[model samples]
Target chain A: MRTYLDCYPCFLNQALRAARIATDDEAKIKRVLDEVGMMLKEIPLDSTPPESGRLIYRKISEITENIDPYRKIKKESTEKALSLYPYLKSRVVASNDRLLMAIRIAIAGNVIDFGANWGFDWDTEVADTLEKEFALFDYDKFREKLDTAQKIVYLGDNAGECVFDKILIEEMKKPVVYVVRGAPIINDATRADAVQAGIDKVATIVSSGTDAPGTILDTCSTEFKALFHNSDFIISKGQGNYEALSHTSASRLIFFLLKVKCRVLARNIGVEEGGIVIQAGRDR
Target chain B: MRTYLDCYPCFLNQALRAARIATDDEAKIKRVLDEVGMMLKEIPLDSTPPESGRLIYRKISEITENIDPYRKIKKESTEKALSLYPYLKSRVVASNDRLLMAIRIAIAGNVIDFGANWGFDWDTEVADTLEKEFALFDYDKFREKLDTAQKIVYLGDNAGECVFDKILIEEMKKPVVYVVRGAPIINDATRADAVQAGIDKVATIVSSGTDAPGTILDTCSTEFKALFHNSDFIISKGQGNYEALSHTSASRLIFFLLKVKCRVLARNIGVEEGGIVIQAGRDR
Candidate 1:
């Protein structure tokens, strides 16, 4: 997504904060500030409220100054995710159909997002509305199928969300395989993070290899294909997974996620803004 | 600026590359490689060629992902500054004199700093450097003192460079007061930078306000007699300016810039690992 003008100041703030934390020499600090100012001028800004952008900028600044800005935020975000388990479990149990139950479980497993990402709390009012809407379905037949399946594969998004996924897998007590994008940018979870979170111990972690959001099925490794062949259900999270895998003939694939930023996704699922969707593949 | 083992993959390579170019989708690029398998469980072989940290991590990825990361790079890099000049001139002229000679005058009319704060340029590198380096210099005895006095300022640095100082200023061509840190940091030019650069337009740019590198000089305003009394040299650049003036200073300041990673800077400045610095003052 193009950066809004609102984001420009935030970038400056981040750079300034980094300078504060990184240096003590006055001349050096001056030099860094000069560079930061130039950067701000060079980048174009999207039209946005200065207030919102400023807040984000300040937060980024604080993070740079404090060092490891992502870690603390990730920790807090994960706690929020964990806190939502009760609501998620209650909603899933209250669902009318097995499909709804499966969808809820999959969502509660955690959202794997791609592109135009925003950090949102899973327990917010918007999220609650989404859960309620998706819970009104039946997925019992799918659940029966899943019970006999030997393996399940999950694609993840962002970093903190990965922790929540690990929690979901442990609760389900099903053998799970985790997949992620590889070697592209900071902020996304990595194989090291999985190991750090101990997800590696329970699940086979794999790399998609490509940087594009859409899943290129042909790019799947032999191991990934083998797991897919044996699994009865494949739970894909976020829009990227859907965009990539929607054309597949696998009837067992279920997509669970929130309608955060994409118009195309909202149209495809026939939902309005902030909608929660659970889409199952048609029998081929 | 010794890099930590954990920061090498993303920080040195991915993030640097992103910062150098403009891209359309930074977040998408950020999310593309978030898998467990792609991460280096053991540090990659040290034989991997060393790369420019900023170029590797911040530039390439930002451009490839379609994010315009160079708004600041283009604005503050030395290359961009050189283009500001109408003709070929000295980029970083140095001298001990209070006023630059004829050769300096030819190129001194417009200084294009690679990484100064805001967008102000120098008329002469030598005079500008002297004004900044020796704020207390007895300019009356110098033959070029009268000729050096003008309404231009040069700003430089990246990340924490002071861009906002210019924002607060109502006018550009006045007795501008340029501010610097009264200390030194790694790889930062001294007050000599302003003088040698022949920055005669500035009335005074002092390091009195900031004691440490990147420390925000909240009191830098017309109200503060010591830092901004009859001050025409209201140009500050780099991380030092940002650290000292982004919040408390109300005076109009122009900043120049370039984005250089801290670790790399430390190496260039030949300082101990993780050192911080500021510019120098008469007291020092």
Candidate 2:
């Protein structure tokens, strides 16, 4: 779960990417990238990369003077995903294993994220994740846990991915609390993004009350923390949640549905970069 | 020739690769990568990436306290090329165009550099460069020049590559002054490395004075510079020499015989990365 040396350059790259997305101001981008260089030594090698990621993005946002710089991009991303909803739904419904199909669809949608991936091929990713064998699939265990679970807390990742999460939640048919960020942090889905994605139509939408880009439990509100602790099971989506929560509260039956994007996170999950994973609980 | 933003991560990656090759010490590798991170901002975006590259490798040498860390590896690399010499020479002899064949062989040999590349497969590269279409081939112009030229000043790149260069020199049938480094810097061919590769038997051997890992004319000895100036034609090999000399003295009948490697150099040559190039001159 600790950050690797390789993550250092990536930190800068992510900052550069965020700056590019935030504005077309050449001067602003240069200033942000320069700040990233200045802050390199401050990165904690022992902490998770997402923790470092949050810090970098925070600095980027501070310099740009826009807390939600990805605001328009998030809305545009949600609209893009919504455009795919009907086609994706039909694919899941036609599949023999609807749950499995929906899970892959949701994970595939994780690629819609703006904060991590700069851009991704939509059609190829959808077909591959749905049809191809996963690098880490614990579907049997996940199904077993879901069968007995009373309540599910789904930790959402990005704007566009929230729409995919709704499709998966519909498949689960459980009492679900789809968690969104209380404030904007990178491109992580805020309650606004979730609403834009129509996630409220499928489950009770709640804010995590932290804008750390991931569920850093210490930074979350008491209400969300209590709800998280009370939940019988959790479905965590994307690398941000995986990085932040993989080491802490790992024994609490959190199934990580994510694509291994970065080297450090991939190593932590014991999969190759670009590997599709459906891991059953971090402790398991 | 200026460093692109893309080159920053590559610089760190190169430093890490060198650190990994230098010693198995994990801490040393981490230290070197950290040093590279520190040096990132100091890089002049308005200058060539190799200028930044030299600063990075120089730091690695300082931190590891070992100049020419690739010494043993260079020897082994030369031996690997030497083993293929006879087979390659026969291929050249059997070919319809001996000059063009020799040119490809020499360009293929450029991949043997330890400073620019980590490891390259000799057989595949040699086969492909010989069989495939070059991204840039000014062979017609080069042949016209070579028909009248009496002397060639050959700039050598790496140790193992010098062996391949020898095979090309045999095919050229012209008087050649082989230039190697005065001192060790990466796996670049030094006087000792060139001597070991039997370059002395094939051509007149000399050294550029400085160990900057490139043909910086100002840093080169007066004798070598004079020889370079006096030569009727120049056969410049590898990316290092290309970076240093490509812009300044490009019109002085220099035939760049090298593979396009690295993003910056590839961009400089106006070709795709991994391109096999035999450019007539920078301006041409």
What is candidate 2's lDDT per residue for A1-284, written digit by digit as tens? 67777777677778877887777876677677677876776776787766777778888888888778889888988998899999999998899999999999999888876665667787787777777679998999999999999889999999999888889999999889999987888888999889999988888999988778788777789999999887779999988888778777554569999987767777778888888998876553
Q: Model 1: runs farther than 4 Å from truth?
A: A1-76, A83-102, A108-114, A119-121, A125-131, A135-141, A163-173, A184-188, A193-204, A209-211, A248-260, A282-284, B1-284
Instruction: Give the per-residue lDDT digits (tens) of candidate 2, residues B11-128.
Output: 7667877877777776777788777777777776676655666678888888887777888988898888888988989988899998888888888888886665666787787787
Instruction: Give the count of colliding residue pairs in each prediction.
Output: 162, 1
Error of 2 at B117 (Å): 4.5
Candidate lDDT scores, in order, read: 0.41, 0.82
**Candidate 1 lDDT, B113-199, residue by residue in tens:** 222222343434424532332212222322232235465343333211222222222123345554443333222333434333323
- Name model 2 segments beyond 4 Å from true: A23-31, A63-73, A113-119, A282-284, B113-120, B250-253, B282-284
Candidate 2: residue A91 lDDT (0-100): 91
TM-score of chain B of each: 0.29, 0.93
